[model samples]
Target: MRFDILTVLPGLLESPFAHSILHRAQKKGLTEIHVHNLRDYSSNKHKSVDDYPYGGGSGMVMMIEPFAVCIEKLKAEREYDEIIFMTPDGVTLNQGLANQLSSVKNIMILCGHYKGIDQRVRDLYVTREMSIGDYVLSGGELPAAILVDAIVRLIPGVLSDETSALSDSFQDDMLDAPVYTRPADWKGHKVPDILLSGNTPEIEKWRFEQAMERTKARRPDLLE
Candidate 1:
């Protein structure tokens, strides 16, 4: 899979894709992430990509031309499965959505800034819109990083044990059961007796029951 992120602050995203699982994914050829500077597509001599919103607004709106040029150029290279604009008003992103996107071949993420992008840009180019949550952020750079991580990690071979992503919390509409590491006994606590038991079926049943209990106590909404 490949992702092209259009942002005015490309430097802000440097560290996110440079380390951890994302970096490993890139190295292993499981995925490719490229951050494109919106300024590079600006028509103005000063490379301006944002301007005051017409009719009155508190902050500047990202202009349409830069986004259009960048997206069009990228589209020429390869067909994009989705052109997603990151905004607070967009559909709240979830694990299911990440799983869906993991199957796509190409994606273009637009990181909105200031008062957000010109509406025409969204209407003309964006195929989907997503938000990490209901809250707002200073810019979409961080959210884009988060979205990329969520989707990329679900791709086959991205994780050493591919099954690891399948068992992640939310994959089954229930929270993951509690887990314990080595030194089975720690302080006054101990690993679950069932987990230590060699009976696979019994251990699996215990894990499911624990997951259900925790989900009911925490995110009961998932059960519904």
Candidate 2:
């Protein structure tokens, strides 16, 4: 998979993709992430990408021209499966959405800063819009990182154990079952006897039951 992130503050995204699973994914050629400075596409003498809103909003709004220039240029080079705009009002991102995007070959993520991007840019170029949650942030960089991480981790060869991603919470509309590490009997806490037993079938059944029970208590909406 390939992601082209367009942001005025590209520096904000440097750390997230430079470490951990995302870095390894890039190293193995399983995915590619490219950050583009939105200012680079600006025609202004100051290289500004934002301006005060036309109606005199309190916050600055990202200019449409630079964004359009960048998106159009990228489109000419390759067809992208989704041109996503990260905004507070977008559809709430979910595991299923991440899974769907993992199959896409190319993507472009536009990070809105200041107040937000011009609506015309969204209407004309964006194929999808996603939000991490209800709360707002100073910018879309963090949300974009989260989105990239979710999609990249699901790509084949990104994780050491390919099936690990399959069993992640929300993969099956249920939270993952409880897990225990070494020192099974730490202090007074003991690992579930079923897990310690050498009965794979029984253990699998127990895990499923636990997962369902936990989901019922915590997020019954998922089951529905």
Candidate 3:
């Protein structure tokens, strides 16, 4: 998988892809992440990428020219499966979406800043739009990072135990079952006896029941 991220403040994106699973994914050649500075495509003498909104809104709007140029340039290089705009009003992202995107070959993510990007840019170029949640943020950089992390971790071989991702909380629309580590009997607390019985079938059943009960208590909406 290949991800191209376009942002005015590329610096905000540096640390995310440079560490942990994302960094390992790149090293293993399972994925490639590229960050493009929107200002590089600006035609203005001062290399500005934003301007005052036409209707005189309180916040400035990102200009369309540079964004268009950047998107066009990338499209000319290769076809992208999706051009996604990160915004508050977009479809709320979920695990299923991340799983689907993990199989895609190429994608472009546009990070809107200031107030937001011009609507024309979105209409002309974006194929999809996504939001991490209903709340707003100062910019889309953090959301883009979140999206990339979620998607990349699902790619094959990205995680040491490939099956681990399959059992993540939202993979089956149920939260993960409780887990215990070494020192199973710490202080007065004890690991469930079923887990130590060497009975895989019974343990699996117990986990499923626990997961259902926890989801019912904490997130009943997912069950529906």
- Please list the C-alpha lDDT of all candidates, in the order they appear: 0.96, 0.96, 0.96
Worst 10 residues of 3 by lDDT: 51-60
TM-score of each: 0.97, 0.97, 0.98
- The runs of at least 3 residues in candidate 2 whose Cα sits more than 4 Å from the true structure, single-residue gaps closed, are none
**Weakest ten-residue segment in model 1 by summed lDDT:** 188-197
User: Candidate 3 on 62-131: residue-level lDDT in tens?
Assistant: 9999999999999999999999999999999999999999999999999999889999999999999999
Q: Please report how far candidate 3 places residue 76 from its true position, in Å.
A: 1.0
Error of 3 at 209 (Å): 0.7
Per-residue lDDT over 137-196 for candidate 1, one digit per residue giving the tens place of the 0 to 100 score: 999999999999999999999999999999999999999999888998989788988888
* Model 3 residue 135 distance off true place after TM-score fit, in angstroms: 0.7
State how far residue 11 of model 1 sits from its true place (Å): 1.2
Instruction: Write down the RMSD of all candidates, one decimal each.
Output: 0.9, 1.0, 0.9
In angstroms, the error of model 3 at 98 is: 0.9
Off by over 4 Å in 3: none
Superposed model 1: Cα runs more than 4 Å off? none
